[model samples]
Structure formats: C-alpha cells, structure tokens
Target: MKIIAISGGSGSGKTTAAKQLQQFLGNDDCKILSQDNYYHDHSDKFSGDGSVNFDHPDAIDFHLMAQHLKLLSENKAVEVPIYDFVTHTRKKETIPFKPTKFIIVDGILILSQEILRPHFDFAIFIDIAEETRYSRRLKRDVEERGRHPEGVKIQFDSFVKPMHEMFVQPSRVFATHIAYDNNSLANLFEDLKKDFF
Candidate 1:
C-alpha cells in the first residue's frame, strides 16, 4: 500500500485535493484519513476566550494517528475517530476503516509531525496566497462548521496564520510535490498516477 500525505494551510484545499485523488484512483483503491478527526478533544478546555490554538501541532493526537497508520500498513483494520467541529470534541462512535491500495492522509499539520512523516510514501503541500486561504476558510467555517464570521477572522489572525507560518509552511520542504491550486493538483495527479498506481 502507498501512503500519501496531503498537507497545507487550512482552506488551502487539502481535503478537496485528497478527495479528488481518491476519485481519480477509484474509491475501491484509495481511502482518506483526515487529520481533523485526530484532533485532541478540547471541549472541556475551551473557554471561548481565544485560548485554544487549534492550528498548533500539539492540538493533534499524532501518536494515535501514527499507530493507526502502522496498523493499516500491516493490513489491519482500525476504527477511526469521529470528531465534532461544533462541540470541539470527538464523538463516542468511530468509523471502521480498512486498508486499501492507497491511503491519503489529509491535514494542515500532518507533514509537520515527525511521527507521521515516516508513514507517508509521498507528500504534497498546497500553496496559496494568505488572503485567498483566509477567504476560503471564512466561507467554509461559517457555512459548514457553524462558525461566526467575526470569530473565524479572529481565530485566523490569532492562531491559524501564525501556526501556518511556524509549522505548516516549513513542512513544505518535506513534500514531493507542491500544488498551488486545483489545476496544479490535477496535473500532479496525472503525473503521479502511473508511478503510484
């Protein structure tokens, strides 16, 4: 099995790229493991005072994700966690995930984590202007995650941008390919399909 890591700043279309690659490779041959699901539950700690740094690498359960990756590589089935964005916590139930020919690990911090890096056979980093990323994030948070526009802006300024610069951007050196947008990602996919599949 080949493990692909798709890392980028929030709203840089990491998930979309992963899904697109999965579709290109066929659903039966590829599966996606989202790093968002491995976020450490912060429901009890959230005070709504902008204290929580969700973009930080510390916010993720990298060890558990690494373990799951190892198990999957060994052809073992695993129960992936389900996270609730609104509550900022993980749900009690988990979704069972079986290994496939390819696994795409999607997240902003996946490439930043040393534990998870070795699991990836190939890595991709999506690059975009900060303004574009912020705009996309604002729309997605407000529309899909039930976040207020003002709150999203505040968090983007306080946590997301800084963390992206500190953690996410530096990790770009680890990527085998860097995609600027969906079109580039598609082109890269076409080039990689024969090599990987």
Candidate 2:
C-alpha cells in the first residue's frame, strides 16, 4: 500500500500499532507520520503555555500535512515538522521524511477530516476501553511524556474524555480495520503482509 492511516482516540494504542507496522514493513519500505506533528502553531497567538484548545481539529495545520503527503505521494522529499507536546509547539527546523513504499499516519484526529481521506490506501483504528485508555494515558504521560499525573487526569476529565464522544468515537465507523484491546502485533503484522505485500 502507498499509505495507511492508524487512528484512534488519544492513548488508544495507535502509536504501538504504527510502530509495529513500520518495523514489520521495514524501515526502507515504511514511513510513519504522526498527526501530532501538525498541531496548530500557538507561539505567536496563544501564550507559550499551550493554552490553546488542542482537542479541536482546527487546532492542527491540516493544510501543511496535506502538502507533505502530496510530496510523498509524488515520490518527492518533504520535511516533517517536529512537535513538542510538553512545549506544545513545533520546532524551528523540520527533518527530512521520504518513503520508499508505505506511509503510516497515526494520531487521534487524522481520519476525521475529509481533506485527508483520499490520501490513504487503508485506515486502521485502535480502540480501547475508556478505563484502559485513561490508565495507559496516565502512565505514559507521567513516565514517557513528562506530564504531571494530576494535570493529565484533569485534562481527561475536562476535555479529552468528552471530546472522544464528541469527535473521536464517531470517526471509528469509517475505519477499514478496528482493533480493540488486541496487542497481537505479530498476527496483525503477518496478516497485513498477506493483504498488502
């Protein structure tokens, strides 16, 4: 496949699946693009504190993302933005991103916009229970992402959780594949090879 999208609500295991698929598909043949990389620029507008409402689709620069995808689809080089969530802004410099065969785009709101729909050959959704997602998010943010547990919990309660029902959950219906609490990357990897290779 030229491009595949791995999408779901935040902390729903989309990252894990994208990584597994990339490794299985091979680094030379696979490229992963996170929609998180396209987060809206708030440096000039909002305070450096990332006080902007990030849960909304308007909070991302989908136009830039589309341009990057068009470049890859045309077999050209593109620079992907590096986004720092802790700082909640993109860096000044972008790094080169070129793919040989497959491109895997992963994030929460990737598939929600129709502007991105025509770019994907296939789309997969990683889904988990609210309790599991919340728990996993709490741990990952606290440990890996350097986020405060209490802050994460508060965001979940006030924004993340409600937005899932408002936006994320409905997008699941459009997915070609739906994975729920299933960590069987090996089986999924092998199955994908049969389907795509």
Per-candidate local distance difference test: 0.92, 0.81
lDDT of 1: 0.92
CA RMSD (A), model 2: 2.2
Residue ranges of candidate 2 with Cα displaced over 4 Å: 43-51, 183-187
Put down candidate 2 lDDT per residue, 49-96, tens digits, no spaces. 224566778888998998888888999889988887666668988989
Which predicted model would earn the best TM-score? 1
Instruction: List where candidate 1 sits over 4 angstroms from the true fold.
Output: none
What TM-score does structure 2 among the candidates reach?
A: 0.90
Residues 1-197 of candidate 1 have per-residue lDDT tens digits of 99999998998988989999999999999999999899899999875545689999888888999999999999999999998988888999999999999999999999998898999999999998999999999999889988888788888999999999999999999999999977899899998898974
